[model samples]
Target: MQLFIGNINGQFGELEAEETQHFSRVLRGKLGQEIYLTDGKGTLAKGVVTEIHNKSIQLELSEIQENFEQRPYFLHIAIAPTKNIDRIEYFLEKATEIGIDEITFLKSFHSERKNINLERCQKIVNAAVKQSLKAYVPKLNDLTKFTDFVAQDFSETKLIAHCEEDFERKNFKEILQPNENYLILIGPEGDFSLDEIKLAEENGFQGISLGHQRFRTETAALNAVFGLDWAN
Candidate 1:
């Protein structure tokens, strides 16, 4: 099915500018042709191409389906933004495709990148959601300090991925409880400092290993995502 992204709330609506390009140039949607749209908020609406303009296309909704079985549990990944912006973007796209509810770029003591292109990241995730045919858009939160992020009241199974060999960690399969919200922490290239790790532990974030192999920040974040998917 050709899935477009838009809102058809009151019987009629128009595709957003970014979506208009796909409607005309990529999909070549024709008037009267049936199309599908998701608000990326769990609602999928069936609509027909009503009018094709130069830059925007009008749509009329016919039917709507709400997704209720969106992952029984929440998987929120909080990771330090990689030095290379592309690396973080790669992780964002892949993780969104795989399935994620929330993502937060963190500012860590060892982190190289302080801020990320919020708008760009949003577009990447939005495109991934449509490409992967997902109804819910994984939210991209503002960059947060490591200590501040961990201190917040989060889901039951809060985990922090680290490369320290001395730290006691367990496989997610052995620790994760199904159907409960989860918040995972992934550090940067330099990894988390001893103090930051301790802070997380104090905040009830358990140490979790993504296996023995050392992984980059992006890889570790994606690994955490797959780990939760497996547990689910």
Candidate 2:
């Protein structure tokens, strides 16, 4: 199945500009050919190409599926952006392909990279969604300060993954509950500061450990994603 990204709400819709290039220039898509388009908001549309113009293509919708391939649980991972941006990019791609509901780049006290190129990260996510044939688009947020992000009430299962050995940490697996919304925090290379951990704990966030083996920022984030998938 050839899947493209587009917002198809009614009988007629247009493909995004980049998608048009992929359809016409790369794939040589022609009119009347059937293709699938996803808005990345749980809407999967099957449509026939009706018109192809410069930098755009019109579609006549045949079928639409809402909540397409929706998962039982929602996962949100907020992780400190790694110094090497590529590592975080890899995590985003793989996590999206595997399945994720939301992602927020974190700027922690120990964070090496203070800024992130959200556009590039979003492109990677979009491509992964197409490649993985996933209907829901993971909600991506810009770089957020650790303190500010922690202060919000997620109203879900909240967890913080850190390497603070002095403080007793709960095994992530022990706290897994089916079909519950989750928000997990992954700290930077140096891990969350004692003060930051305390702040999180005070705000109802439980500190948990992914495993005995310590992982890098990106790897730990991905592990949390996988753990959630496995648990559910």
Candidate 3:
């Protein structure tokens, strides 16, 4: 089914300028063609085209379905932005496709890149949601200090992914529980500092390992996402 996106209240529908042009001039959808519209907040509506114009496409809702499954519990991933922005963008695309609740870019001591293009990241997320046929849009947070992010009152299950020796570590899949909210910390290329891990532990974040092999920033983030899906 072709899914279009709109705001939460379903007041105004949105289509990219290109999409509007294509639907009007290229595909030429008729007035009665059925289409699916989503608010990106778990609300899906079955709509029929009412008008196809150059600037906009109008639809009349016939039926609506609300996804009330409680979102499979929240999965919030905090990671350092990669030096090469493409890798982080790729991770965001795949993570959204696989179903993550929120993403935060942490400013770490060992982080090489300190800045992120929010606009570019949002575009990637939007495209991924359309490709994955998902109803909810994952929340994207601005870059924040590692210490500050670690100190927040988060979900019940909080984990820090670090490659340290002292702490007793388990694979994320082993630690995660189904139907419970989770927050994971993924570090940058140089990984988290020993002191940072200690601070996180002090703040109630459990240290967990993705696996034996060393992974890049993006890989680690995606691994955590996989772990969450497995647990769910």
Candidate 4:
């Protein structure tokens, strides 16, 4: 079953403008065709095409499927955007496939890049969700300053990956607990500055290390995602 994304109960069925075009012209879907639709917020709806217009595709609700339940734990990563946008985009794609909950681009003191292409990153995530057949889409946050990003109220297990000495660092796998929300920080090419690391620690983010070997910004972020203990 092909799953299309739309705002659930947005007025004209579950189909949006782009979805409508794809249904009519791209997929050549006709009236009475069965298709699965998701609101991206967890609700799944079953519908059959009722009206196909140039600008809109309408569907008659056959059934309102069950809402999706995410993993007991949530994974939120705040990474410094890479100079190569493709790398960050790749991270978004793979992270979504692996079941990340939220992503935020951060501007660190030594960050090589300070801007993010949010629109393009979203498209990548959307494609990944469809490819992975996931019910819930990850939330993408706008680029934020390092200080501002760390100041958010997150009651989960928070960690920051950095390469500074004098601070005891634990492996992400060792520190993460199952069924608990987690927030991780990954720095840019130049990595996080000493002051930035201190600020994060003061703000409740525990210092951690992915491994001894150094990694790129995107690689470290993905490693953190994969290393999370999601069991239980």
Query: Candidate 4 — which residues are off by over 4 angstroms?
Result: 10-12, 229-232
lDDT of 1 at 35: 77
Cα lDDT, model 1, residue 8: 57
By summed lDDT, which 10 consecutive residues of candidate 1 come out lowest? 61-70
TM-score-superior candidate, 1 or 4: 4
Clashing residue pairs found in predicted model 2: none
Candidate 4 lDDT for residue 11: 28
Candidate 1 lDDT over 102-127, as tens digits, reads 99889999998988889999999988
What TM-score does model 2 achieve against the real structure? 0.95
- Put down candidate 3 lDDT per residue, 126-165, tens digits, no spaces: 7788777777878899999999988888756888999989
lDDT of 4 at 70: 60
Give the lDDT of residue 120 in candidate 1: 95
User: Judged by lDDT against the true structure, how good is candidate 2?
Assistant: 0.89
**Please, what is the TM-score per model?**
0.89, 0.95, 0.87, 0.91
lDDT of 4: 0.82
Better of 1 and 3 by lDDT: 1
State which candidate has the highest lDDT: 2
Model 1, C-alpha of 208: deviation from truth (Å): 1.4
Model 3 weakest 10-residue run by lDDT: 7-16
